[model samples]
Target: MIITKAKPIEEILPFLEGKERIFLVGCNVCAAKMKTGGEPEVLALFDYLTGLDYNVIGWAVPTAACSVRSYESLVEKNEKLKEADCVLVMACGSGTSVIASILDLPVTGTNDTLSLGGQIGSSAINHLCSLCGDCNIGDYSGICPNACCPKSQINGPCGGSKNGMCEVSKTSECVWYIIEKRMKTVQTLPILNKIKPPKDHFV
Candidate 1:
């Protein structure tokens, strides 16, 4: 799932200083589930802006805000978006880009889109994919350092690891330790012998 968090209202207010008519957009898939850009959050922003004495034209929470087709349909239906002075997108980075591409108005964001992550349950999640495009999961028995490690260490720990914890974060564990333990349990340590080459930055 794509992780996202709401930007502080204080930080967002600066963008609306001179603007009057505002159009709000939200995402219904990733941000909706994350509670950052869903309809409820959009409505809350609408009220907040109303309290601040801005004319809110309209708001739409697209089912998939990252889809060009979905966002186009929303703009076509609202029409207020065309008249508004600017648009505020309360979605992930991908979704925000989609809205900006399909609109002629000034576009702004209200959420910080985070990494692609894995969900352990309904609420708990952890970063799972860094989208490096190299995909070395086969080398480490499906574990990926790019996703779990702070330094994006490809080979092993930096020797700062102590008591199975990462050098940077006390709450986070050393990814190499997890990889080593998994390899030993499955007797797949031999796979690590085929070291990964340097990642191609061009890709």
Candidate 2:
């Protein structure tokens, strides 16, 4: 899941200021869960825009705004969008980009793309999981060293690790502590002896 927040209403109002018809598009995937640009949010926007004297023609919530299939369905269902003065995309930057590529009308982003991680709790906390396009967590005892370590070291605990905590902060748990415990449970502590080379930035 990607986390996003809606742009200020003041900034967004200018685009549809003099426009007669506006289409408020919502993404049902990430933005929906984040409470940014979901169906309810779009409806609220429509009401506000309509109250501002702009003619809000209609609104739609696509299953996944970034998906080509979902985008096609939205385009087919909302034929009125063609006549709209502009399309306000209440989705991540990628979703808005997709809308722009397919639509001739002016497309605007109502949200800012934050991260590619999912929700942790009440707050949409995301771990810095670097999707390097290749995963090596299996060799690393199911631990994502890329995100676990501040320095992103893959071999073993850094010199900064103290009492199973990171030197950066006492609240920060040491990634190597987690790796060691996991390796010990599986009797694979010998793997830690193997030194790993520095990460290839291009990779």
Candidate 3:
């Protein structure tokens, strides 16, 4: 899933400075899960903007704000959108870009795209993939040092690691340590014998 966080109100306020008719768009998937751009959030923003004397024509919490089909569906049915001079998108940067591309009016986002992550039970795990063209996650039992490690240490941990924690940050568990533990658990310790080469950044 794509992780997202709300932008400060101060930043969003500037985008609405002179806009009168406003149409708000929210994401129902990732942003909804994160409580950033859910239906509740859209309604809250709608009321807040209405209280400020702005005419909020309409709002929609699309199934996925990133989909062109979603916005097309909205445009087909929501006549209120046609009256708006600008759109406020409560979703990730990708969603904002999609809206901007489809709409002729000015479009702005309320959320900042954080990272690609997944849910581990109730916990949200981030930095799972760096999106490097070259993937060698299979070698480390599905752990990618390029993304999990602050230093991007592929072969092993830096000498500064202590107590299974990264030297760069006391709060972070050393990725190499996690990789070693995972390798041992799967009886693939011999895989560690093979050295990994430097990452090809050009890819």
Best model number under lDDT: 3
Higher-scoring candidate on lDDT, 2 or 3: 3
Candidate 1 segments exceeding 4 Å error: 70-72
Q: Rank candidates by TM-score, best first.
A: 1, 3, 2
lDDT: which is higher, 1 or 2?
Answer: 1
Q: Which candidate achieves the best TM-score against the true structure? A: 1
Candidate 2 residue 106 Cα shift, in angstroms, is: 2.2
**Regarding lDDT, does 1 or 3 come out ahead?**
3
Candidate 3 local lDDT, 10-107, one digit each (tens): 89989998898999999999889888999999999999989988889999888888986744677886788988999999998898998888889999
Between which residue pairs do clashes occur in model 3? none
* Candidate 3 lDDT trough over 10 residues, lowest sum: 68-77
The TM-score measured for candidate 3 stands at 0.90
Q: After superposition, how far is residue 116 of candidate 3 from its true place, in Å?
A: 0.5
The residue pairs found clashing in candidate 2 are none
Q: Give the per-residue lDDT digits (tens) of candidate 1, residues 12-92.
A: 889888887899999888888888899999999999999888889899888878886854587677878877888899988
TM-score winner, 1 or 2: 1
Model 2 ranges off by over 4 Å:
10-20, 70-72, 119-125, 148-190, 201-203
The residue-by-residue lDDT of candidate 2 on 9-114, one tens digit each, is 8888777766677888899988999988888999998888778788888888888788856445676988887678788999999899988888778889999876
CA lDDT for candidate 1 = 0.86
